[model samples]
Target: MRVTEVVLSVGIGMLFAIGTFLVLRRDLVRVIFGVIVLSQATNVYLITMGGIQGVAPVVGGHGGHGETAVTDPLVQALVLTAVVIGLATTAFALVLAYRVYEEHGTIDLDRLQGVER
Candidate 1:
């Protein structure tokens, strides 16, 4: 694998690790952020799946022999779609967390779950 691939793979792993840790926290906001992190990691993995290219996949692109080393366009499109969905989901989660905070006056999961008098 290339250096770029190695770095991205390591980054994805780290993001997943951190996200998992955050998701286990007692704060709703932190859990939301963790989900966002996990989404980002998934996006990175998608990008890496496209493979690295030395040139664009166009007519007469590179090598002068009509040869080209283009990355998979479909992966790029998928990553873009994932990014937009991630943004929307993150926004919705934040709104929900905000509403929960307003209603219960706390973002902690334990406090929110406790019976209220």
Candidate 2:
């Protein structure tokens, strides 16, 4: 694997770990951060899997070639769509979180769930 890929993988791994930790928190804000981290980490993983190794997708993209060099566009398109959808999900989560806090008066999940008492 290339150095770029190795570094990115490490970073994304860290991000996913952090996300898991944040999700475990009782605060709703932590959960939001966790979701965002998870989304980004997932995108990173998808892009990393599509790595081309010293090659750019377009003949005229970053690594220009006469015409012979080209990565698959379908994977690229799918990644883009996934990113957009992830963003939309994050936005929706934020909205829902705000509403939840408004109704519950506290971001703490433990407090909101009365079964603990």
Candidate 3:
């Protein structure tokens, strides 16, 4: 694999690790940030799967040269869709967290659990 791929892979791994750590925390805001980080990692992973070495998928974009690999448009579309969905999901999660905080007066998972019981 190329250096770029290796670097990106490492980055994705780091993101996942950080996300997991944050998600495991007791704070609701941290959990939401974790979810966002995880989603972003997924997006990066999807983009890397599409391959980095390629010309844009456009008519005559290769400068009238010989056969050349074009980056997958489907991957771009999928990532775009994922970004939109991730945004919506994050918004919903934040709203839910806000409501929970307002009702329970604490965003800490432990405190919330105590209140629930």
Candidate 4:
């Protein structure tokens, strides 16, 4: 494996670990942030799966180039969709959290769950 691949894999792993930890926290804000982190990690994984290439995947342009690899446009499209969806999802989560805070006067999971502590 190349250095870039190793770095990207490690980064994705770290993001997942941290995101999971934060999601399990008692704070709604932290949970929201964690979801964002997880989404970003997923994006990175998708990009890596497409492989690193210097040329675009265009027919009759660079497709005939010998020994040249073209980047997959499908993966890029998927990643772009994921990013937009992630943004929308994050915004929705924030709105929900805000509403919960306003109604309950607290963002703590335990407090929201009727726990005295």
Best by TM-score: 4
Candidate 3 residue-wise lDDT, 1-117, digit = tens = 689988998999999999999999999999999999999999999999997777788856466467778889999999999999999999999999999988989899988877553
In candidate 4, what are the lDDT values of residues 36-82, reduced to their tens digit? 99889989998998887557776565436474777889999999999
Instruction: Report lDDT (CA) for all predictions.
Output: 0.84, 0.79, 0.91, 0.90
Candidate 2 lDDT over residue span 6-117, tens digit each: 7887898899999999989888888898988887788778766775553555444554445454556666788899889988988898889899988988778888886474
Instruction: Give the clashing residue pairs of candidate 3, or none.
Output: none
The TM-score obtained by model 2 is: 0.79
Considering TM-score, where higher is better, how would the candidates rank from best to worst?
4, 3, 1, 2
For model 2, give the 10-residue run with minimal summed lDDT. 58-67
Q: Estimate candidate 2's alpha-carbon lDDT, on a 0 to 1 scale.
A: 0.79
Model 1 Cα lDDT, one tens digit per residue, 1-117: 688878888898999999999999998999999989988888888777787665555545355576556677788888899999889989999999999989989999988889454
TM-scores of the models, in the given order? 0.85, 0.79, 0.90, 0.91
Best by lDDT: 3
- Report the Cα lDDT for residue 116, model 4: 87
lDDT of 3 at 50: 90
Positional deviation of 56 in candidate 4, in angstroms?
Answer: 1.5
Cand. 4 Cα-lDDT: 0.90
Q: Which portions of model 2 miss their true places by more than 4 Å?
A: 52-54, 60-69, 115-117
Q: Candidate 1 at residue 97, lDDT?
A: 93
In model 3, the Cα lDDT at residue 20 comes to: 99
